[model samples]
Target: MPWKELRPMSQKLEFVEKAIVPGANVSALCRDFGISRQTAHKWLRRYRDQGYLGLVEKSRRPASSPLATAEDVVVSIIELRSKHASWGPQKIAGVLARRLGPEAPSPTTVARVLRRLGKVKRRRPAARIWSVDGRPRIEVKASNDLWTIDFKGWWRALNGDKCEPLTVRDAFSRRVLAVALVPATTAAHVRRVLELLFRKHGLPSAIQSDNGSPFICSRSRGGLTVLSAWLVSLGIRIVRSRPGHPQDNGGHERMHRDLSELQLSPARSRRAQQRQCDRWMLDFNHVRPHDALGGKTPAELYRNSTRRSLSPLLPTYPPEWLTRRANKAGYVRINGDQVFVATALARQLIGLRQESELRWSARFFDVDLGMIEILPIDHAYLGGTVMETVTTVRPSERARERIPVSA
Candidate 1:
């Protein structure tokens, strides 16, 4: 036969009732109720002092906790969290340490507090899958070694106006150099913004961008666009991310994710939206702490490049190499014939080196254009009286090769 379960309160009441009887043995009642002598005495004392209500269970919690977080400190954490809703416990803890000094709680404590207060939401762990693309990523050792630029996808403002923000960031320091609102995605508009950035922050060794309009032309040789060509002229190496792979620039994409999370509601106007972006950028650079940067703000690690922005942005070639400026129609005169280069490279200097007797290699700065083949054309139309010079240009197979360090 199975034993019937007894409620704690009912058992205590029965034991107390049996013990209260005149000449009842309390030790016998304690053993019968399967309770210790001290417990039986405690229950009997409470019963005598306060009748049947005392038989009920009482709380075991202490009246106070000495190591509990202070009300003021908790208020400060909550306030900071309320201000930057997108920040995690680590970032919040960083700000707290800055504000509260030695009294600041650790990230774990902050996480506990936030979780207890229902401010922190549990997120699923992301899969740690490695993606490989054969191309090597540009190594960033200093502030201006590499800069990543991209346009955040456009969204409609509250007033129904489109808002597209151009973001430029230093790869090493993770500092956002600029967040400008361009009127269009044209090369000219982007160039104007970049010119200002170059003047302010100086030139980076390389600039990375996706293969999109204003950055690259898919049909063009080496995916060079007008902006990229100008960048090449300034002696900056162009790094391109693989098509359809945003993970190639994961850090920049994560920043965009933060921006999206913080700025959920669209502003009233483009100007207002820009002002919001400016505020967000200021906070992102100065206030928000990055886990990848050891809980330090980007502004703390970022420094302007030593390479200054100067006029007459022309690339210097070796003394042995021959140089020629392409005409406005993107044609360069090789020997006696005009060969078409790139429209993006119009008016840019083209370096030529003789590879063989009939074949000559053409390069724009460090980028190889192609092999320029000089062919003798016998004109039958003019009864072979005049010899016509024909130039045949083929796209260089090595055009998409890795950029040189000197570039």
Candidate 2:
């Protein structure tokens, strides 16, 4: 009977065993085993060279793989990951290429190495919310085109001093113009910090901020807080994100996240915290590679604005407008009736333009502060005295005997 050939492994072993016996015919075994002469001879050669173990399946992989990533390149990727735990492979590869020249592994290869090394953390990405239907999307054209400001939630320092950091970042370049640790998020404190930033960085075209204290007031017209009002007075447009929407100021929020992580080792005093902030600001602007900036530091892309910083004094109005100081109470007495301006302009000069005898227009710098209408006096009360009383007006009420006022 012919040797069993049902299983390839058993067939190879049996064929080799019978053919190796002295005086056995290899051709006859090939015919009986349903294998060609070439196949029988190949198996016999392998068995003769390596014994029965060689008859078992051999790996099909090549002996050498020149296309595989180099050991040193993988090592370098691991080293960079160790140095910056938060950096992904794209940034890692960027840095490695800069340091190690053109031969550095690609970002995809680096990602693979990270996975092999158990450094990659697979996370289910959050569903992308793509609709910007009502959101104000500002296209940043240049460094000083737009600036984003925010107060990172306050935290107590080791010395028990509350530190509410006012962060100002160039929206286009990601340059952190300031990271001042203020005692509070009051309009005055934030305004002072912004004044210094404006003085150093010059005036931006617009300032984008979240709807919060000093930036926005619920009671104020157009949600213009004192700080925003002050910015408008400087000819800088004020842009506020939608309420409860942090994604609108995502880049600034990301910067705040980095700033928070920088305080890993808490500073005992405000002075120490400020020193750390300054140091981090320097690093963030000059040292850290920004992925959005093509791995270049923020300082590399940023340039001071062509618009020179003003003295922070009230801007000069035309001669036709009447200049009055917004008294400590943030009101201007018009026709014996007190009108509320903004506290930000408190003690600061504002202009009032009389559009007509009974109508007046209030202004701060170039920004209009609604028109004041002389309301009819109560003739029954005080012998027909026309002491005017007014109410807040909207900008849309141009011809409606009302003036558009700034909130």
Candidate 3:
């Protein structure tokens, strides 16, 4: 919702307070107001602090200052706040409180300390509302509990090709499992990347992504996409960032910013970009110490003691589902549905979780096959072009040949 559409702060606070009463339907009001319950509470917190005055319009600028503070003290706060401008009084206070000990005043004093040094700028309303709280306030337990996945917003390369980074990061370790660059991000490409991750990392307990088509979160389809559906069948839950709230997936977004700032630059060529990305992923997983993790690297955290090495092969699907073997032609017939698979998948069986309706659920190996977009109940296949499908198999046979022909 536009700022013009929302009522004044006083009215919003009043309405939310009234709506928050028992049986008042807070969710409905939140939807109507285009705000979250958290946002509503934030205003409520201000209301409790300064009463109706808090509800009144106020400047982001500080209203008070501290008396006779040491120059070093003020300067230190300045440097810290400069490093993390998004940090609030509470976080800065926590840092100071630990240092100053018995002499630490209130949070207001710390804000004043920052203010006196001129480190704390008057909060910009737009910046305050738009900037995310990326303080690592949440902690991840164990490896692979959650993987934040997203296509890095596009960036231009020196070669003129657009780079859309596909990133999958473990929430627990902050470990970036993959950072793939492609001209375009599509469901098929993303599926291949995810397949590799699954084969290597076992699986995450859940994956969080945006509502974009590639990520596939829509009310009409209930956000079910090939990727999400594949994860779900493996007993992995999927969480979507709230609509219009990009900060809901702050970790992945921050990683994108870091990549742009530190790894890949606009002047780098395609090969250079790939090389830099490869180096960055290596250092990010193994070398860079995470402040939130007490200076530990992501690799130290992504390791799952529960499962050392990932299983060598994909698991077979359950027996109940109708199974059809892909012929040499890479086509399968199941429940009258004709699926044209890549020729490389020949001899591999695809399972269809037969349902009561026309819809069919497909599975491959342990990972549930999400992208089972078979052409027709009987049509051979349709994947961009017939030549495109045929060309993909040549590399796989070469790869097979590269391996020893026999033991």
Query: Residue 365: error of model 2 in Å?
Result: 4.5
Error of 2 at 145 (Å): 1.0
Per-residue alpha-carbon lDDT of candidate 3 for residues 26-61, written as tens digits (9 for 90 to 100): 777777677788977777787778877776766886
Please state the error at residue 297 of candidate 2 in Å: 0.9
**Index of the highest-TM-score prediction:** 1
Weakest 10 consecutive residues of candidate 1 by summed lDDT: 398-407
lDDT of the structure predicted as candidate 1? 0.80
TM-score of 3: 0.42
Between candidates 1 and 3, which one is better according to lDDT?
1
Instruction: List model 2 lDDT by residue over 299-368, tens digit each.
Output: 9999998787564545788888777887886777666556666666677677888877767777776555
Q: What's model 3's lDDT at 202?
A: 77
In model 3, pairs of residues that clash are: 217-223, 218-223
Worst 10 residues of 2 by lDDT: 398-407
lDDT value for candidate 2?
Answer: 0.78
After superposition, candidate 2 runs with Cα above 4 Å error: 1-134, 221-226, 312-328, 332-338, 347-371, 379-388, 395-407
Preferred candidate (lDDT higher): 2 or 3? 2
Clash counts for all predictions: 0, 3, 2
For 189-288, candidate 1 gives per-residue lDDT tens digits of: 9999999999999999999888788997765645677889989878899888887888888889988887784358889988899999999999999999
Ranking by TM-score: 1, 2, 3
lDDT of each: 0.80, 0.78, 0.64
**Per-candidate TM vs. native?**
0.60, 0.54, 0.42
